[model samples]
Target: MNFDPQTLRYDERGLIPAIAQDAENGDVLMMAWMNADAVARTLQTRRVTYWSRSRQAFWVKGESSGHVQHLVDMRVDCDRDCLLVLVDQTGPACHTNRRSCFYTALRDGAEVEIMAPVADPD
Candidate 1:
Protein backbone atom coordinates (compact mmCIF):
# COMPACT_ATOMS: atom_id res chain seq x y z
CA MET A 1 0.00 0.00 0.00
CA ASN A 2 1.14 3.49 -0.82
CA PHE A 3 1.56 5.91 2.08
CA ASP A 4 1.05 9.63 1.83
CA PRO A 5 2.14 12.27 4.31
CA GLN A 6 -0.98 14.27 3.58
CA THR A 7 -3.10 11.38 4.77
CA LEU A 8 -1.98 12.03 8.31
CA ARG A 9 -3.96 14.40 10.47
CA TYR A 10 -2.32 17.73 11.26
CA ASP A 11 -3.11 20.54 13.60
CA GLU A 12 -4.31 23.98 12.48
CA ARG A 13 -0.71 24.93 11.90
CA GLY A 14 -0.27 21.97 9.58
CA LEU A 15 1.90 20.26 12.16
CA ILE A 16 1.82 16.84 13.76
CA PRO A 17 3.41 15.51 16.92
CA ALA A 18 6.27 13.06 16.43
CA ILE A 19 7.62 10.99 19.28
CA ALA A 20 11.08 9.49 19.06
CA GLN A 21 11.73 6.17 20.76
CA ASP A 22 14.77 3.96 21.21
CA ALA A 23 14.49 1.13 18.74
CA GLU A 24 16.34 -1.51 20.76
CA ASN A 25 15.19 -0.76 24.32
CA GLY A 26 11.75 0.77 23.66
CA ASP A 27 12.50 3.91 25.63
CA VAL A 28 10.80 7.10 24.51
CA LEU A 29 13.40 9.72 23.69
CA MET A 30 11.68 12.93 22.80
CA MET A 31 8.63 14.53 21.28
CA ALA A 32 8.69 17.19 18.60
CA TRP A 33 6.57 18.74 15.92
CA MET A 34 6.79 17.99 12.23
CA ASN A 35 5.37 19.44 9.09
CA ALA A 36 4.71 17.35 6.01
CA ASP A 37 8.00 18.35 4.47
CA ALA A 38 9.86 17.49 7.66
CA VAL A 39 8.27 14.06 7.63
CA ALA A 40 9.25 13.51 4.02
CA ARG A 41 12.81 14.62 4.66
CA THR A 42 13.16 12.25 7.61
CA LEU A 43 11.93 9.33 5.57
CA GLN A 44 14.08 10.19 2.59
CA THR A 45 17.26 10.78 4.56
CA ARG A 46 16.76 8.33 7.41
CA ARG A 47 17.38 11.24 9.74
CA VAL A 48 14.83 12.57 12.16
CA THR A 49 13.61 16.06 11.21
CA TYR A 50 11.29 18.26 13.18
CA TRP A 51 9.66 21.64 12.90
CA SER A 52 10.86 23.84 15.70
CA ARG A 53 7.95 25.93 16.87
CA SER A 54 10.20 28.41 18.65
CA ARG A 55 12.82 28.58 15.92
CA GLN A 56 10.11 28.51 13.25
CA ALA A 57 12.26 26.36 11.06
CA PHE A 58 13.12 22.77 10.27
CA TRP A 59 15.27 21.04 12.91
CA VAL A 60 17.26 17.95 12.12
CA LYS A 61 18.12 15.82 15.12
CA GLY A 62 21.80 15.67 16.02
CA GLU A 63 22.57 18.41 13.55
CA SER A 64 24.17 20.64 16.16
CA SER A 65 24.75 18.17 18.97
CA GLY A 66 26.42 14.81 18.22
CA HIS A 67 23.38 12.93 19.50
CA VAL A 68 22.04 11.75 16.19
CA GLN A 69 18.87 9.73 15.81
CA HIS A 70 18.92 7.42 12.82
CA LEU A 71 15.48 6.47 11.68
CA VAL A 72 14.69 2.79 12.20
CA ASP A 73 10.93 2.97 11.60
CA MET A 74 8.11 5.43 11.52
CA ARG A 75 4.62 4.53 12.72
CA VAL A 76 1.34 6.38 12.59
CA ASP A 77 -1.13 6.43 15.40
CA CYS A 78 -4.65 5.01 15.08
CA ASP A 79 -6.07 8.49 14.75
CA ARG A 80 -3.37 9.44 12.26
CA ASP A 81 -2.61 12.53 14.32
CA CYS A 82 0.64 11.40 15.91
CA LEU A 83 3.82 9.61 14.87
CA LEU A 84 6.17 7.21 16.56
CA VAL A 85 9.73 7.19 15.26
CA LEU A 86 11.85 4.25 16.23
CA VAL A 87 15.50 5.23 16.01
CA ASP A 88 19.05 4.18 16.71
CA GLN A 89 19.79 6.99 19.12
CA THR A 90 23.43 7.88 19.65
CA GLY A 91 24.39 9.56 22.92
CA PRO A 92 21.88 11.50 25.02
CA ALA A 93 18.57 12.36 23.37
CA CYS A 94 17.76 15.30 25.61
CA HIS A 95 19.52 18.63 25.28
CA THR A 96 20.35 18.34 28.96
CA ASN A 97 22.28 15.16 28.15
CA ARG A 98 19.66 12.86 29.60
CA ARG A 99 18.81 9.59 27.83
CA SER A 100 15.21 10.71 27.49
CA CYS A 101 13.40 14.00 27.79
CA PHE A 102 10.88 12.53 30.19
CA TYR A 103 13.21 12.85 33.14
CA THR A 104 10.74 14.00 35.72
CA ALA A 105 8.07 11.89 37.35
CA LEU A 106 5.08 12.97 39.37
CA ARG A 107 4.79 10.50 42.20
CA ASP A 108 2.55 10.83 45.23
CA GLY A 109 1.68 14.38 44.28
CA ALA A 110 5.33 15.31 44.15
CA GLU A 111 7.58 15.91 41.20
CA VAL A 112 10.84 14.03 41.16
CA GLU A 113 13.66 13.76 38.68
CA ILE A 114 13.94 10.14 37.68
CA MET A 115 17.01 10.37 35.47
CA ALA A 116 20.31 12.15 35.56
CA PRO A 117 22.19 13.68 32.66
CA VAL A 118 24.96 11.69 31.06
CA ALA A 119 28.52 12.75 31.54
CA ASP A 120 30.08 14.99 28.94
CA PRO A 121 32.43 13.52 26.39
CA ASP A 122 36.11 14.35 26.49
Candidate 2:
Protein backbone atom coordinates (compact mmCIF):
# COMPACT_ATOMS: atom_id res chain seq x y z
CA MET A 1 0.00 0.00 0.00
CA ASN A 2 1.30 3.45 -0.88
CA PHE A 3 1.61 5.88 1.99
CA ASP A 4 -0.19 9.17 1.78
CA PRO A 5 0.77 12.31 3.60
CA GLN A 6 -2.82 13.40 3.75
CA THR A 7 -3.66 10.23 5.65
CA LEU A 8 -1.80 11.58 8.64
CA ARG A 9 -3.75 13.63 11.14
CA TYR A 10 -2.95 17.31 11.07
CA ASP A 11 -3.94 20.10 13.37
CA GLU A 12 -6.31 22.88 12.40
CA ARG A 13 -3.43 24.62 10.68
CA GLY A 14 -2.72 21.55 8.58
CA LEU A 15 0.52 20.97 10.36
CA ILE A 16 2.13 17.96 11.99
CA PRO A 17 5.11 17.63 14.29
CA ALA A 18 8.20 16.06 12.77
CA ILE A 19 11.12 14.89 14.85
CA ALA A 20 14.51 14.48 13.25
CA GLN A 21 16.82 11.77 14.57
CA ASP A 22 20.36 10.83 13.77
CA ALA A 23 20.24 7.72 11.60
CA GLU A 24 23.64 6.45 12.67
CA ASN A 25 23.50 6.94 16.44
CA GLY A 26 19.81 7.29 17.14
CA ASP A 27 20.27 10.72 18.64
CA VAL A 28 17.30 13.02 18.31
CA LEU A 29 18.34 16.12 16.42
CA MET A 30 15.38 18.45 16.44
CA MET A 31 11.66 18.82 16.07
CA ALA A 32 9.85 20.93 13.52
CA TRP A 33 6.48 21.33 11.88
CA MET A 34 5.53 20.05 8.46
CA ASN A 35 2.61 20.43 6.17
CA ALA A 36 1.60 17.83 3.61
CA ASP A 37 3.56 19.58 0.91
CA ALA A 38 6.67 19.58 3.06
CA VAL A 39 6.28 15.87 3.61
CA ALA A 40 5.99 15.20 -0.08
CA ARG A 41 8.96 17.38 -0.86
CA THR A 42 11.11 15.69 1.75
CA LEU A 43 10.27 12.25 0.41
CA GLN A 44 10.70 13.29 -3.17
CA THR A 45 14.00 15.05 -2.69
CA ARG A 46 15.45 12.80 0.05
CA ARG A 47 16.17 15.93 2.02
CA VAL A 48 14.31 16.94 5.12
CA THR A 49 11.98 19.89 4.73
CA TYR A 50 9.85 21.64 7.33
CA TRP A 51 7.15 24.27 7.56
CA SER A 52 8.42 27.36 9.27
CA ARG A 53 5.48 28.84 11.12
CA SER A 54 7.40 32.03 11.77
CA ARG A 55 8.35 32.44 8.14
CA GLN A 56 5.17 30.83 6.88
CA ALA A 57 7.20 29.01 4.25
CA PHE A 58 8.91 25.78 3.37
CA TRP A 59 12.21 25.36 5.21
CA VAL A 60 14.63 22.99 3.54
CA LYS A 61 17.18 21.76 6.02
CA GLY A 62 20.69 22.97 5.36
CA GLU A 63 19.49 25.37 2.71
CA SER A 64 21.20 28.30 4.39
CA SER A 65 23.30 26.93 7.26
CA GLY A 66 24.79 23.93 5.42
CA HIS A 67 23.50 21.70 8.23
CA VAL A 68 21.63 19.49 5.85
CA GLN A 69 19.49 16.58 6.90
CA HIS A 70 19.39 13.78 4.37
CA LEU A 71 16.43 11.52 4.91
CA VAL A 72 17.07 7.88 5.73
CA ASP A 73 13.52 7.02 6.70
CA MET A 74 10.28 8.66 7.74
CA ARG A 75 7.85 7.10 10.19
CA VAL A 76 4.39 8.04 11.34
CA ASP A 77 3.31 7.62 14.91
CA CYS A 78 0.53 5.27 15.96
CA ASP A 79 -1.85 8.19 16.28
CA ARG A 80 -0.66 9.53 12.93
CA ASP A 81 -0.27 12.98 14.39
CA CYS A 82 3.50 13.05 14.45
CA LEU A 83 6.45 12.00 12.30
CA LEU A 84 9.86 10.55 12.95
CA VAL A 85 12.47 11.38 10.36
CA LEU A 86 15.67 9.39 10.55
CA VAL A 87 18.35 11.34 8.81
CA ASP A 88 22.04 11.69 8.19
CA GLN A 89 22.53 15.04 9.82
CA THR A 90 25.46 17.25 8.89
CA GLY A 91 26.71 19.91 11.34
CA PRO A 92 24.69 21.24 14.23
CA ALA A 93 20.93 20.79 14.07
CA CYS A 94 20.04 23.57 16.46
CA HIS A 95 19.75 27.12 15.21
CA THR A 96 21.98 28.14 18.12
CA ASN A 97 24.74 25.96 16.64
CA ARG A 98 24.22 23.17 19.14
CA ARG A 99 24.09 19.56 17.99
CA SER A 100 20.44 19.41 18.89
CA CYS A 101 17.70 21.81 19.77
CA PHE A 102 17.17 19.96 23.04
CA TYR A 103 20.38 21.23 24.51
CA THR A 104 19.02 22.16 27.90
CA ALA A 105 18.15 19.46 30.38
CA LEU A 106 15.95 19.69 33.42
CA ARG A 107 17.78 17.90 36.20
CA ASP A 108 16.50 17.94 39.76
CA GLY A 109 14.28 20.90 39.12
CA ALA A 110 17.10 22.92 37.64
CA GLU A 111 17.95 23.63 34.06
CA VAL A 112 21.37 22.52 32.96
CA GLU A 113 23.24 23.21 29.76
CA ILE A 114 24.44 19.84 28.56
CA MET A 115 25.87 20.87 25.25
CA ALA A 116 27.72 23.87 23.91
CA PRO A 117 27.35 25.60 20.59
CA VAL A 118 29.50 24.40 17.74
CA ALA A 119 32.27 26.69 16.65
CA ASP A 120 32.07 28.08 13.17
CA PRO A 121 34.43 26.36 10.74
CA ASP A 122 35.46 29.62 9.23
- In model 1, the runs with Cα more than 4 Å from the true position are none
lDDT by residue for model 1 over 1-122, one digit each (tens)? 25679999999999999999999999999999999989999999999999999999999999999799999999999999999999999999999999999999999999999999998878
What TM-score fits each model?
0.96, 0.95
Clashes found in each candidate (C-alpha, N, C closer than 3 A): 0, 0
Instruction: Give lDDT per model, in order.
Output: 0.95, 0.95
In terms of lDDT, model 2 sits at 0.95
Model 1: per-residue Cα lDDT at residue 60: 93
lDDT, candidate 2, residue 24?
94
lDDT of 1 at 78: 100
Model 1 gets an lDDT of 0.95
